[model samples]
Target chain A: MSDSRPVFFVSDHTGITAELIGKSLLSQFPGQAFTFVSLPFIDSQEKAEIAVRRIEAERARSHLRPLVISTLAEPELRHLIAQTDSLFLDIFPCFLQALETELGCPATPALGLAHGMSDAGQYRARMDAVNYALAADDGLATERYGQADLILVGVSRSGKTPTSLYMAMQYGLRVANYPLTPEDLERTELPECLRTYRSKLRGLSLSAERLAQIRAERRPDSRYASLPNCQAELQAAERMLRAAQIPIIETTQRSVEEIAALLKQSLATA
Target chain B: MSDSRPVFFVSDHTGITAELIGKSLLSQFPGQAFTFVSLPFIDSQEKAEIAVRRIEAERARSHLRPLVISTLAEPELRHLIAQTDSLFLDIFPCFLQALETELGCPATPALGLAHGMSDAGQYRARMDAVNYALAADDGLATERYGQADLILVGVSRSGKTPTSLYMAMQYGLRVANYPLTPEDLERTELPECLRTYRSKLRGLSLSAERLAQIRAERRPDSRYASLPNCQAELQAAERMLRAAQIPIIETTQRSVEEIAALLKQSLATA
Candidate 1:
């Protein structure tokens, strides 16, 4: 049976947790097909009407009601959405109502703080390092490179950006990354911005074949994506990093979480 | 009392579980200043050495032995870490050693792959969405704006990037975002990109004062960071969006997660 169901996640803040929970719940119904979308930070009545209209349109198109999982705190918006034909799972209202009834008092406005904290200074320092590595221009990053707690260097498509951003967001670390261009490989020297902050620098190496495959997706039939070029770059970059005494992490087989954790450990140690 | 301590989190493949266990164990020591670091996917001898050196350095600097919590699968790395001058707590080793004496099998490779598959897709999708959102460029994003599973448009510093990335990472959705710049506001019309993708666009509107506060942090004492300018931009942008029949979400007091959740719900219902 073909199922043309749409699933929507609406939130008043970062919808990440709700999306995860919704997806996990949806997984229980194996073989079910659905199109998923997220509408983040819905706070006004006018926006609520737009969301309601979209649900109405989807219901008319598919001849089946969509499912909405929301965690919005605004009562009027929730009421507006309820008018739609969709099946609604309002996270905040359901949970808060139950909690309020049980406690015999109106639910207190709960401030959703991040689950954990890292040292603010250390986190900022790490972020600075990542920013230095990824900064568009070299001159500005150079003066500030030394302030970074950890800097990541890798060839393009080496999973540097996501890894750096993950470190910054999850750990509140300032992370900077620089893509090692062919010029840098030919010179067999670190980027000038990276030299003074050698102690903070860490190299992210990927398998040459995997690197080529990833690069091929973005820029097909390019010299940079060639197997031989990839191999040469990998070898030269590793040799340069090794000679400079900069630590290296092979990210080809590792997940983002693994790489971030490894980077964190390296930073703490350094 | 200047008490400095190094905190550590060690894990094998299941870092989340290890983090939980380690946090629980670490709670026993109260009133001690510490730094928490996760050491995930430490599968090899070389990687183990990298972790050990970090622990050793932390121990030396703080004059307090570092806390080493591990679920290292390899016996050799377990032995190597044990030799370090720190408080070593190897969860897997302790459990395996105890269980081996009691049970027949060594329990090296535990069974129940069923538990592994439970939330794998959700986790993967979330990670992919996050990566995609971060890598999306303004121009490319504009072209595919209507095809987006969700779209976020906002004034500068209204928390669009983080929210969009969070949605993608947490829900595995293609999220496209466009910033409603000052020029667009003055014209009293949505950008051409947003105009084409009106149906998919969801606005993130923050209080003008709040927007100014956020922008001030990034570019202090600039015209872009002025409260009056932010107020004007927000008003003009909202008016333009309303005239075009687009939806807007106010993000004045909401958290990122909350915003994302609301967005997900809206899309799911839509």
Candidate 2:
């Protein structure tokens, strides 16, 4: 089957939490198919009623109990959505109650605050970090490197740009990535600019075969995309980073989110 | 009172679901101080034991129960972390059991599958989308716009680039953004390239004050950053978009996540 099990990620804010948790749960029952819909900005009774109707209509059409994972924060709206006879999974009500009991205060049930412009400072920082990632990508031998929270170094297609952008976008990290050139790999010593910011450096390492596959997408059949060239560059880059005591992340089989999370955890533990 | 409350988001995979849910729950309780850490890649018994020890150490130092929100998939690791005796929030266990009973099948438990390279096709699509966003940014009247899934059109600093990149990175959408210059805003008709792709156009709308503030960060004291210029350009652009029946997203008070989700919902419903 396809995405046709009629899954709804209902929430008061952006519905991101509902989507994340719902998807995680569904991934476990891999072969079971479900069509997911995220109805964000459902911050009102009217919208909640609409969501209930949508779910009801799905139940009528599919002749099956639809699945709903709701992160609705308001008690009233939560009850309204729960009125649906579908297999309702109220994602956050019990947890919020537990948290409130622990914190010794009731949660403030405000709308659109969980992941929106309510925190202007954090929002601006993330935007600024995205701008920094765009500006500081590739060979930037400039003073702007000083402002970076971290610098990623790797040979081409070793997963620098996407990782830098992901860290910046998700974690508000000012990440700059410098691609290790063939000349930089040839040199016995580490690049001069990178040496100055050695403490902020993290190396991204990937297998030569994977690197060639990626490079082939851009410059196919060229010597730069050759397996031998990729092997040599990766070997030299790894040796240089190891010699300088820079921690390296093997990104051959990891997604951007995985790379960013592992790297963030390393920074936190370090 | 800052990031010092010793909150741990432990997971067997990327920890993103744990982080997103944990942060959402924490955000509900305002003014409660906490420093959160995401310890991803916790797939082994050794890592689970280390996490327990870390939580125990935090409990010893803070003299308060540390908050732990774990998404560990393995039942054994989950049991191991449960021994910590802190204010543990095992985020997924209860939900997973409920889902299993609902689906009439036992979940095939595994580590590091929620958000990683386990689905290589989706991962490659996201990377390709990011590359597409980079290649198709700005007034790209090029033939490459034909390949775009969606095209965002707005005045400078009205939030086209960030939205494009965010959509590309998060939702794996090939988003291409086109900046409307003074000349395009002055014209009665939409720009030639944009007119052809009117069906895919999304307008990002924001107040003049916010636009001026954002532009000031890039080009301070310039006419482009002046309030009047911002006001005039936004007015003309909004009118032009309305004439063409393009949906405008007011991004002045919305995060990138919210905007992307809302846009996605519109697409799904449409």
Candidate 3:
């Protein structure tokens, strides 16, 4: 009996690039159950044989040809992997050749260089941004508010922390988020520090029902997680955002990537 | 003169997939100062027109043709964007057609569906992993040790936290990390609790010089940040990991993505 649940992402490096591309493509066909198998750092012929055997075994057992999404840079390794008894989708060779033609220059086939520590400065900046986000989370690092590239404010569970962390990790953007508490919402205006950085402020909001459900998971059946309380808090937060005249985004139906990308676009335009 | 610093990642949806691919490709060409502009959610003809105008303006001002890496799904929008004077690399069309040919199926042109909140279960699981990572950071949530998918042990600044977060965010893996304190390193045997879950443990180690440099940035010249102290701590941690017979990877020259992928591979194989 063949199991049709395993999907392979193989690469000579971290396999992240291949996984991202593979996952995006697989997501379009969403009904199938997928068990993602990441085989990274496959830089040798021996390792490539192991991967081929694994894929073959999966194919033999499942009665379905397993899909292998590969980003291997070396021609010989890629050729070897392509010989597996499965549907192979090598992501790099096609695009790399086309890009070489477009640029009229041969690309340096560098292995393990896609996401390595080649740029120490950029790595440090990213780490620093991550630390800043952790410190400034939930209005804790108020003194460093001025250093923030963007200040996101919203009610709890509005998807602020993840957005901030995504921005920091992906773009090295220094993001600080403050949760809108009852005291802050009681007053009709934004916080004083937020006012000073008003131009850089972003707001996130979600559906009251969704907010209540999320909070219920954390603290069940309390006033803090009640639907009525969610409604009132959201109403106050929306009113404060309107009073401030800042750009607000709804996270009810959007993913964290969408929210972060929207914020990045606004920052570029501003 | 057109500005050469701006690089645009254009997409009809979240633009994250395009940005990831573009950033990975661009990082190969080091020494170029690049400013990234993400133009996401361009679902309408009017919005596409706005994006074209923005690209043209950048091209006209900078005197250099701007590079536009796009992931637009709609044919009309992709065709419209390719008409711009700038150099364009549409990431989806080139591969989608090939994939369609390979799969013997026509892909529906679905806009904004790649990274949306369509799978509530998967989204919730990812978020739960994130919350779990945060709660279990620095040995804080010891009660949930049995629930962890992987336990990472390392000295401070050995790249445990970010790796844990990346695993949770990218792959929805519940990761808990414990810093090997001096007290723990002074002991001969593994911690009592860790011994129970030794099969699920992964270790991280880094070069003493690099570790010292990273610590010096956070806390300057103190005993905890001193080179000798870092050397001794790392030596002790490495020995303990060896004595415990758990797998360990060095983070001295690798990115968080690489470390996480290595661990993921180990998990899959185990």
Query: Highest lDDT: which candidate?
Result: 2
Q: Write the per-residue lDDT of candidate 1 for residues A106-191, one digit (tens) a residue.
A: 64332222221223354345334334434522223556655555677877778777777666655657666777888888887777
Prediction RMSDs, each to the true structure: 10.0, 1.9, 2.3
lDDT of 1 by residue, B1-270 (tens): 676567676554435445544443333233345677776666678878887887888877876667666656567778888888866665444333433443223443321111133446664576567656755534354655555777787777677777776566545687877777777777877777667666677888989887897788789999999999998888888898888877788877665555766687677666
Which parts of model 3 have CA positions greater than 4 angstroms off? Answer: A1-6, A31-35, B1-6, B28-35
lDDT of each: 0.66, 0.86, 0.84
Model 3 error, position B203 (Å): 1.6
**Could you give candidate 1's fraction of true interface contacts?**
0.07
Specify the highest-TM-score model's number: 2
Q: A1-270 in candidate 2: lDDT tens per residue?
A: 234688899988788889888888888887787888787878889999999899888888884578989888888998988888777888777788888887778888766576887788988899999999989999664479999989999998788988989999999999999999998999967898889988889999988898898899999999999999999999999899999999999988888888998788778766
Off-target runs (Cα >4 Å) in candidate 1 are A1-112, A115-140, B1-10, B14-135, B138-141
DockQ for candidate 3, C-alpha atoms: 0.56
Each prediction's total of clashing residue pairs, residues at least 3 apart in sequence or on different chains, is: 53, 6, 9
Assess each model's interface with DockQ, reporting 2 decimals per model.
0.09, 0.77, 0.56
Error of 2 at B162 (Å): 1.2
